[model samples]
Target: MPASAFDDLDSYIALPRVEALALSPDGRRAVLTVAALRKDATGYERSLWEVPADGSGGPRRLTRSAKGEAGAAFTAGGDVLFVSARPDGDDAPEAGQLWLLPAAGGEARPVTRLAGGVSSLAAVAEASASVIVSADLLPAATTLEDEAVLRKKRKDKKVSAILHDAYPVRHWDHDLGPADPHLLALDLSALDDTIAAAVADEAAEDAEATMDASTPYPSSLPRPRDLTPAPRRSADVEGAALTPDGATLFAGMRRSLPRGSRSILVAIDVASGERAVLFDEDGVDFGEPVVSHDGQTLAFVRRDRGSAERPFDAAVWVCALDGSGARRVAADWDRWPTQLVFDADDTALIATADQDGRGPVFRLPLDGAPVLQLTDDHYAYSHVGVDRARGGYVALRSSWVESPHPVRIDADGAVTPLATPAPVPSTTAKLTEVETEASDGTRIRGWLVLPEGADAATPAPLLLWIHGGPFASWNAWSWRWAPLLAAARGYAVLLPDPGLSTGYGLEFVARGWNAWGREPYTDLMAIADAVVARDDIDADKTAAMGGSFGGYMANWVAGHTDRFRAIVTHASLWALDQFGPTTDDSEFWSRIFTAEGMASHSPHHSVAEIRTPMLVIHGDKDYRVPIGEGLRLWSELAEHHADDDGRLPHRFLYFPDENHWILSPQHTVIWYQTVFAFLDEHVHGREFVRPELLG
Candidate 1:
């Protein structure tokens, strides 16, 4: 692999990325979404593709359109149904519509044309063709046509204001406003009949009728029935699953509390419009419901709301469909399960969890047996699709060395690549895992990316890159925070899993819950010390950088020590008190922090002690940390710091349209260019070079 591969951002963004996988009912065919940069080079477009479940044939593209497709699923009949925004030639709604492609090979056609677009899709496992979808709805609108009219009227009147009686007005990156998400049940049988009639009529018109056949035929679509006809005020439902018989639907509904909101699982009868609470506890939130194929058991996650002493912990819980014999599964397993599905026999469950430094799949038995480890590798697995007939599963596998690709995991524990749309980058950097002992004797582990030509004779500069989610581990491949770019610039990047990081047990996370500036901080420094002592690392030319919680740590590091030549913080929480109240998810933070705790741990108070050169990066639409934190930190630095010249020893890079992350292709390129330039000027003692894109 050549180092020049990482030097160009265009080539990096052009690489095909794979996400989400769905298997057919028979498990012989699998479909996954692939996103690639559009021909215009402005943004990415996603399309559905089919791959052989046995990893035998080349992947074939299924759908191609200017507006791409996503949220793919296989109907019980083995037909592919996906959501897309392709425009209908007639007076159809402009938002996303459900489209279908037959398993026998045919042009994809729309199934429904909802006004506000389809947000999610689900199907019954046993039934032939029963489906449920969710879409955004306008206030007081009963039908799709009415909602469309309301949208047009609002657009004509230029009414953009949203009247909210709820506490939260915005989510992570978007406003949670005038319209809300609502569930709808699609009449798939009726839709199939309508399409069949249209095709028959065209054939009957002439025996020699020869249609273009390649182009999609738009038939009269069937209207969906509103499941939640009259939802509660500001209600937002998610994580919906259907029973094998398609008679019942289980979903998570958010209910507001004094400090925050908690999601409780509720079961809805598909035909009678009757709803019942399946599980609801006082301090524990429930979500991600998965019903067994036998329809006798229901499994979901229970998350405990934290206090100053204990932070949140997610555990898997199972209960009978009749709301009896509820118990927690995998009670002894220290790792937390994210997504799971029941095995074919319904006697065991398979799930993926962050462990050590990788996300591995685990099998938990309902018969009181010990949990079994299914996968042991450096790659992270997500969006798992199980094939009961083959007794195997497929998942999107990714690691630091490779991008996401579809891989089949056989019953015998063997993994084979199903599709590789993008080629791996050519690089000479070596990726290795390292571990060190903290002052408290706790073991800290991290991934070290040593650049090419880095040896004792020519030591490489070091960059300590901390991960966000203070709760998440660095186990997966990330194009955004890729270390290859830094390694291309002759820097060795260290991605450490300090305290509060997942994959470690609860005891490890509890070490930094209330003492954010204590254990986690020290664990990070301890690992850095171990790496700096390596013969191939330049100890003096080191820098620290992070985003979100990692950004918060970078701020803390800048103020506490002058060991690093420079520091970079992005979307960081500087003043915990102010941030706790102003953030989008304020209630979650408020529940965990006390007034004294905020005062003692916040990085804002210690800003005056900073003597290192710093680069502060933030996005205006970052509701997670909020732009106010960046403004405050920048203003404080300008007021408090002064170098030999009149200029302040700091710089600020602001993104007005971006959210917490710089997602745009050009913007991402500029981000890396600016960061490298800053590090070079400060750490390498080189002249400051401004990026051409910024100018």
Candidate 2:
């Protein structure tokens, strides 16, 4: 909490950030998954462990993911189902295969592969039966019907500190080939006895397969009548709910397309072609709807505007079958309600709330009653589930400080811990905080991490690192490994949470409105100046680096100042004019920053001003900040173009497989290594990039 706290990355993160919790329909079992960091062969392995739901049982291992996974569910028969990356799949496949493990502990079975990738999975029961879901494999191709892949390249862009936000549109990217994602529906009946789903058959090796455009849910049971004659893709459906007789199916779709219209909720008789639009939110969204046991009421998460990381403050609203008598049962304005559950008797609503510090599971009555806590002292009590048939609740819990560990509560209220905690390398650096005044005289807060073994007797090189989310802040608790590696190499790190930082107050962050590359950049320089004044930091040898919004800032700084010896940009957008029109939030950027001003700050248009030696990393398939931006910047530098100062040297590293995020442990390590090498070469006077590492 000081200007020198960056001296070392804290070894352990704070704990008890948990999913408040979730229960099963039978109320027999529960699962608790905890997020913990552990070292594997490469480095830290963030994973999920499991345990009983009610309050008893030894912890179990559910997922051994590296970056970790979310959204774990329970099958009717009490099997645990969830999504995660698979080694057998492409690198960063991200299809999120549906994995199943018996509630009592057994080998995880891949029901089926999600070809495009299963973004979501919902379970339902019929006639007191159970269904086993092999896998709702995403279709390898959505439309082979025409014998031609209707490929359309969609380009979207944005700026990030490290260019770490979006992936470019690439032909052979991870999402290419038979991986055209279409929303598919799969229903594992009561106890998972009978299965039904909307599937796309990819059996045609050389030809396109035609869809019936009818009942989509593939099932071992008889084909349900086509409620939707047009049979739109599952991607069009946001949520699904089954009736008591398993006869009716309800679905929701995103409505912000074409012209941003109202979202529609429709009902389809699974057994007959009876379909109807129950309701529509003119300018809002109501999705992830679940039907009450009585089949007369519907509940869903409703809000206004999505896709731009909108604050997910949705309330649980229930309405009659006709879409009338709508009333909000529970709402959380501050935090997103990750999960919602209704007791079998339909008398109580168990909701997962993360409003304050962390999430905690709570049980509330449907009629009306103060919410009651079900679990205490947990951080991210999320990835929660209930295997009522298995007799407990299960969840994956994660902490902001330490690696996540899965914990569960059994029928009798006993808690069990699972998985070993992860180990992070000891930080040779110190972590501290500093406050400075921006050019506009606005107060800005920052986290300054001094290099290890550097003090008044020895000044260390400095790396002014920025965070993405002009709205996101770097506070006491945040995860950024790049600076740690730099510190390990004897360079100081400075992370400043300028105006528009969350957690402080809504008003503080508002100061950053339309102020990109201006005050925010000023804050960065101020923090650098303040830190370098200390005997422990060397100003002349300082460097700059960041991803996404941070990436954009890096581009901006490299173009305007010769202060940095070297700079690295990742998944960044360089041209604001290009980004303004393509971004999903184009209107938003225009409304807040004005379209013209945003274009003026873009680095692409001002490339002639760049002077620093720079490295740019772009994921080939990044849709958020696409690789084109990287290519643009790289090409400009390759042209040997002289800036206002002089000639600039640059290198562009393109990750063909990665998306908006870097997922491979090996790639992550290499990426950090490159960052430190660049800093060390310029800041510490050591050739940073390894010649052998580059191909």
Candidate 3:
């Protein structure tokens, strides 16, 4: 029997992530927006696809585009309503106009004109009576970028350099502006051979992509003409739900002030121009508030937005239509409750959870333990679609071990595969799992993959594989980059789920919080030790490499110990403290790490103590860990190299147009080739491949 095999360095380790899923209320049809492959050398082109509820039927192509096709929903008249990025006209990142198509396949019709991009939409009902749409850049979403635009217009010889230094982003990445979004309710009251609708007075920023937070209605629409005025200020109005009775609209709230969360719900009378705050709280926070089908209950996800480590362990909750009998259904559950839907009978709740490496589906009652296992195999199971007629269950899934695809889980729990635009290749490289303990007696689960032809006792040069998502797991199969590429290079690679990796439960992930540089670092060191102890591995020839969280850890490893001869860090975090103010989550470190913790954990603060030769890579537009981390580390190490011995060697590889994750196929191949050459130089005692530079 073949042991669970592993890859040297597979691209599957860092592939694209699928974000949204929608099933037609009828069940026989489902639509979803799969994330584009990171590289997209061709440019962003994500679209809507159709699948049968049974999972045995082929996936029918519904929508395709060059820029992107996201935010899909089913119209009341049994048609597909989606957003697609138009080409040639504008390169607006958020410019997708709303379009409608019959589920059985017919010409797609443009529902309305969009000044920007459509971010999301809410169907009035499966009957196709009316609809609510959201597009950022619609008037309501147009933010005042006057200052920012003016600054750009004023040219300076040192402008590019200055912008680069201030933003820590590659100049090539998409220019982000003060994004705006709007939500508009459409009146499809006409659906025969034609479609008719009115845009609410202003658009809603329901989709955070544009940062607008009000509903969009054209002047022609009745609701927006009188009293239901558009919102003027920024508010957290993310996530919306349709009441079964179809009379009222609901939205959740988020705040950036004294708390990241607030107990606020926006209740709009869909018919009248009147609206009211369903509820507001100072201590309790609300998010993902969903209006149930019966129209009597409002289901939502709630958590306390505080500095506490477990600020958002959201549980499923419900409230009466009249705002009475409020109670939580599954709040204390450890997993991050994602994609919620009431089952066909409304007797059970199906939720997507990151309990394991793959996003798995779990079924829970209004009050009880969730069914342990619902669907397994494939990358993950989420984006649930429920329709009582088609047995009412569907999911969109993808994983590090497998490409993103759709699957159907029956009432009997048998998962049948569905179709996807980009099907996972039929073949798999190989995978295996081995468990080892770290220095602190904590157990570590690691995988070892061999070159295609080489195996036991082959004495292959070793590539130490690592993963980001410090709170997430480093599992096997379909992740892109790192391991996939390493494996292709014909080296032995090993990946370990260090102490704080997810799927192991709550305590495991929480351990990574303030202990950033400690437990995780220790877990990595122990992997090298395990490899050195094995006879099949050559201790004299070994390389350390990783990206993002893994990259940061690799830097720390090389700086702290010389057990490995070569190191490469990509989109990596060097200074954890500097990460907050410049990153999307500017306040994260302030909450997770205090001044002392930041100083104690940052790799930049400790790099002078490193002895290993290194290669640093960063994308110009990466706002996550940002490019500054990579630049600073490389410059300091190089500067000190000139002053110290000739022993230390290091290089910096910057992707001009890339973000935290290198997406272009050309850049990806070039990156892999460069790092492999670097590893060859030190581990094999010679640069085996000439490094090719991309212009």
Candidate 4:
């Protein structure tokens, strides 16, 4: 790839991306899930690739099919297991099924044939060769055969309606339907016996009968036993961990409340299918369970669901397998762990958490010692897998300047980049830090991405970009909201983590709790002030933009100030009062604000004060910040600014098929095109070039 790959949207979109990493139990091999643009350039197809865990050899593709493969894991015997929708034989189901590739090198075979298919790998036992996978099943299906019959009947009748007995009928991007997720256990150790018996019966009739029975063999792995039976909608498993012996499964299950839900940790006996509550508390939720190497203890995160007054901090808690001797570890640690896994010796936990403006790995000792920072770099780590036998870790790390790639982290905190098939694209943009003191004496910090030639003589135009999650921090590399693309267009992008952004401790988030318009807005203005004052930034040519919570802030900025020449808000909350009842999870937000408090911070009330030209973007399928908010914002903009003929200076870009994030490759290209075009017209004083694909 050329060095200017980031300059062209086509080349940028075609770049291969690494997503997930999995390590073998022996700590010798690592596998990654890499997604590349399809031939049609409409979407991404995921495939598994093998990379050396010891950082010795080049990456090699492991599996290939038109349907592709993902969710890779390793069995105790070193075989690779993945989920794919590829057709197996004449009777193969259309949904995704588990497939296994031998470690000794041979053809891959289907391990499952369930009609509903596997959703994700829940847990894998290192010693027992037992596997647990999550799958969706219809409410009435009592067995795998019954599930297949029910699915076929539904397809034959073309029935698409779903009856809802719960509060949330829709999730972030998809509808929660007649089929809910359930955990299924498969004993891989017993697979050989089942196949042998089937072959014996066939040989009894014909002495020369060959065992060529298709991809799924005459006998696939014995029908998976349903561990979570008739769980309805409450079987929402947040995280799961299996003992090394595969005798017990600790899972975080959601307990549905009258309006909302809370997660609680539970332990299930894998043999008898008996369950017991491990931990449960009011106003608190537990998740991210990880078992010790010896299976004697469990460590999980306990989160307090704060009320309308203050924000809560997430703390790490450890307990015995029987739910006794529960205690919080590293109680003074202010940062929140994004991912957790027991260290090789089981004396500590290897975790990644946001600190300052970067996400780095840390080691938390169970003895209550101070947390030790592991990776002292700018990269954020995820999909961490421990090499228990060898005493190291394998994880995928990325920064603002680099895409996610696998790396080996030694026990002494040294990071070695592993060979990856998806090479990191080169960019000319430079990254730097910027900070300022807020009005309340709090420090506000952010990242400033500058173009190559930006200097005192040639200042680059600025785009103030806010992040979503209101609770999340701008600490990691995001392919969807990359600032490097903006830098390629000769623009500087400001990524500010104002109030309510994590990693700054609970007090920083609490400062903006229930007061989104006060501290967060001012903090953003403070950082913007400090950045614009620099000699390398164009103070006059500036714009503001954000999505989700950041979009809400953009709308707030537009309503309150006219400093920026233009504004862009995507999937933002407009009328908080109307948004309360219409959102997907009304209960969560409702708990954070009173009716009066919501109306006070609402941006729709101040729409008449807006004077800058604005561009509003939304997707019809966005459930978090629904399209109704966008329509309302657009309608109000027209109502307040339209002339006699009902025309206005604002524009609305709507996507009918997209969700909260513009996921489609083609759609992402169009999104950037429209955004830059709008900024060109208002901020750069150039003619707007409409995206050709829109026509």
TM-scores of all candidate predictions against the true structure: 0.95, 0.66, 0.80, 0.96
Judged by lDDT, which candidate is best? 4
lDDT of 2 by residue, 58-121 (tens): 5455666564554555555556666665543332234565556676775565543433345555
Window of ten residues with lowest summed lDDT in model 3: 162-171
Local distance difference test, each candidate: 0.84, 0.56, 0.62, 0.89
User: On a 0 to 100 scale, what is the lDDT of residue 330 in model 4?
Assistant: 90
- C-alpha RMSD of each candidate structure in angstroms: 4.5, 9.1, 7.2, 3.2
| Backbone atom clashes (below 3 Å) for every candidate | 1, 136, 70, 0
Instruction: Give the better candidate number (1 or 4) by TM-score.
Output: 4
- As for model 1, its CA RMSD to the true structure in angstroms is 4.5
Looking at model 2, residue 478 earns an lDDT score of: 36
Q: In model 1, which regions exceed 4 Å deviation?
A: 1-4, 122-126, 192-219, 232-235, 642-646
Tell me which residue pairs clash in candidate 4: none
lDDT of 4 by residue, 1-695 (tens): 44677788888899899989999989999999999999999999999999989989899999998899999999988999999999976667889998899999988888887887889888998677888999999988666666777888899999999999878888887888889889888888766535566576355424423543222223435568888888876567879989989999999998989887899999999888899998889998899899998888899999998888778668999999999999998989998889998988889998898888888888999988889998888788898889887877899998888899999998788999999999888888998989999987999999999999999999999999999999998878898998899999999999999999998899999878898998999999999999999999999999999999999999999999999999999999999988888899998899888676788899999999999999999999998888899999999999899999999999999999999999999999999999999999999999999999999
- For 347-442, candidate 1 gives per-residue lDDT tens digits of 988999999999987889988799998887788899887888878788888887777788889776689888655545567788989999998789
Off by over 4 Å in 4: 1-3, 193-218
Per residue, candidate 3 scores C-alpha lDDT tens digits across 79-138 of: 777776554223223456666777576777656544344556743554435566654331
Please report the TM-score between candidate 3 and the true structure: 0.80
